[model samples]
Target chain A: MSRREQAKEENRARIRASAERIIRTEGIDKLTMRRLAEDAGVSLRTPYNLFGSKTDVLIALLEGAGFDPGDALALRDEQLVMEQLFATLDHIEAFFDSDEKFYREVYGGIMSSAHPDVRSTNVERVVAMCQELMTHAAAKNELQIDTNTRELGRYLGVQLLAVLGMWGAEFLSNQESIRQVRRAWCGILLQHCSNASHRAVDAAYQSVALTGS
Target chain B: MSRREQAKEENRARIRASAERIIRTEGIDKLTMRRLAEDAGVSLRTPYNLFGSKTDVLIALLEGAGFDPGDALALRDEQLVMEQLFATLDHIEAFFDSDEKFYREVYGGIMSSAHPDVRSTNVERVVAMCQELMTHAAAKNELQIDTNTRELGRYLGVQLLAVLGMWGAEFLSNQESIRQVRRAWCGILLQHCSNASHRAVDAAYQSVALTGS
Candidate 1:
């Protein structure tokens, strides 16, 4: 990149880092433009010029922190479906678990806006990303089945996001609870897969018999 | 049923009804003690005499509207696990869908507060109710088994709450999206129960073959 472009990118990163830091120490609600500017050693108008508003700053925080799964398509690069899914979710867990206050602020900021359009569209995009991830999974043996792929994709995607939000609401110190819940989830999915293993044989037999008859 | 006691009981019901009305109309945010008095045609001190603060009014609003699941014990009494689970979640669906304004006000109020402990505790209690409901389902043979009861309960409880909050957030609103996701969940949970159901047979087989050699 050119020197000017590089400088702009560096400035942008500094702003998001400052926002994250302010939220960690002072709470998301307390992250005023003035506070962020003073902390970042920039004029007050700099934050406004860079981020437009606190909510916009949050959008940047999510993006710059590499928590935006939107950026993950680049990582897909013919990766396994289940691997991609785990990578996406693990990134979220690690990102949020990095600091309780930062996660809390981002979540609150996402939902605090007066407009439903912003929140709704953002959710829609995330859900769509999950659907795409699951589709890739089904193509491989990661989630092999005859079930409706799109339907199942939406189901798992939405369920995980909701869990993330609820878990994210708790203090980062509540990692114990998050860990407990995650272990339970893995056990349930694995056990269920084992249980359904027999069903696959039964299903194949039934399909064959019906066709044979 | 003494005259004085009867009068007190009637007045209390009247005051509670007035609080509900205010919430239904103006929402929990505006349901102040003074507003309740004016709505109920009672004295200014009547609300304070009955309930101390705005939070108390919200607690009462939740109770008066029956979003209070009573407790885990009572909610677990339904016949089928899915039926019981849906019934309990239905209470929330009804509450938030009661009035767009009421739902937003209550949720935002609880989340935005400096003191989120009480509200967070209440959410935990609600989650516990789901766990209890799942356990009861297992006890009654409504849910099948392959996994341990605790993990199954946590999985169902935690995941369902995640979906519920998203529904509350209005992120999962498309009717098609809701129905499709719910169906996949039904399939997944039924698959879970089937596994849970077969564990006993496996344990029994471990003891000995019928040859008893």
Candidate 2:
């Protein structure tokens, strides 16, 4: 990369790291652009120039974290669909667990923000991740999605967002949240699974008997 | 009631009506305690004393809209589970359609607010409505949910929020949002329905063939 590009990339990384630190220690409400600039030792306008707003910084933090759905989706026959799906979710759970308050703040910001650009970008990322999983499942004949996979993927994607929202809001216990999500996801898969995949789906559903409400 | 209590109640009602008018005509972002008080011709402290926050006013508006889940749940086999469920949703859709922008703002406000009380109360209300439907379904033997009905109710409730969130964000068309919700809901009911209800669920699913994604 050119020197300018390299410098810009380094600046972004520095901003993101500082933002993450602020969000983790002081909470999302405390991490304004000015605060971020100060923490990162950059000019006041640097945060605005680099990332447009607090939500963008949060989104960048998410992107920087190793939660790539494409990587997760690439596992074709390496594992069962259920296993891979849960693993993908587990990856997300780990992210949330790492900094529960920060994740909640970012999610709440994404959902509640009036900014169209922020909402669209975040929703697109979620839909893409879900589409990756659903598309992979459809291609492998593990799930019997008869309709448009894109629609179904978006459906699943938004559902994940809702579950996380509830979890973040403290309306659902961790086990209950996981259980409810798994049931809904498995319910959809079970409805569409071929006889070949039926046994595997049921086995997977029963494997983790999350007992609490 | 005492005269003082009666006057206080009347003042609250007037304030709410004025707030609703501002929300519908000017948009939610236009709403402020001072604006509401001025519109209602009350003192500035009245709005705050009456409802505490803008979100509380929005919640009151929702409650006043005749969208009571208790009433819906009280229907003991007055209609099939699917019919009752859709009717309840239709009631909500009607509210959304009545003042699309206002409802979106209220929903966005509730979701995004950092106040735990607001989030908990709002989520509990949604969950209660869903649970009412699921509980009623189980009572009438219209559905055979294998897991905890409360959990399923919470699942469906949260999905409804997600769908509304996307709709407000303009990520999904109105028809697509409705279709997606009904499809996922019916998909779940189809899995759990008895043979007697299977035909009903399938018919309901096909009754509204929303074509676009």
Model 1: colliding residue pairs: B144-B193, B145-B195, B145-B196, B145-B197, B146-B195, B146-B196
Clashes of each: 6, 0
Q: What do the candidate models score in CA lDDT, each in turn?
A: 0.56, 0.70
The TM-scores that each candidate's chain B achieves against the reference are 0.59, 0.84
DockQ of 1: 0.18
What clash count does candidate 2 reach? 0
lDDT of 1 at B118: 62
Query: Over the stretch A1-213, how does candidate 2's per-residue lDDT look in tens digits?
Result: 999989888989999999878877887668788898999999999888888877777777777876555575456577766567776666766767786666666666555555678877766777787777767766777665463567667766766665665665566654566565666566566666666567777765664432244
Q: Runs in model 1 with CA error above 4 Å? A: A1-14, A41-45, A73-78, A112-115, A137-147, A171-213, B1-49, B71-83, B87-114, B141-146, B174-188, B194-213
Could you report the DockQ of all the candidates, in the order they appear? 0.18, 0.38
Our model 1 lands, by Cα RMSD against the true structure, at 9.8
Q: What is the lDDT of residue A168 in candidate 2?
A: 57
Off by over 4 Å in 2: A74-83, A132-136, A143-146, A168-170, A173-175, A207-213, B1-6, B143-147, B168-170, B207-213
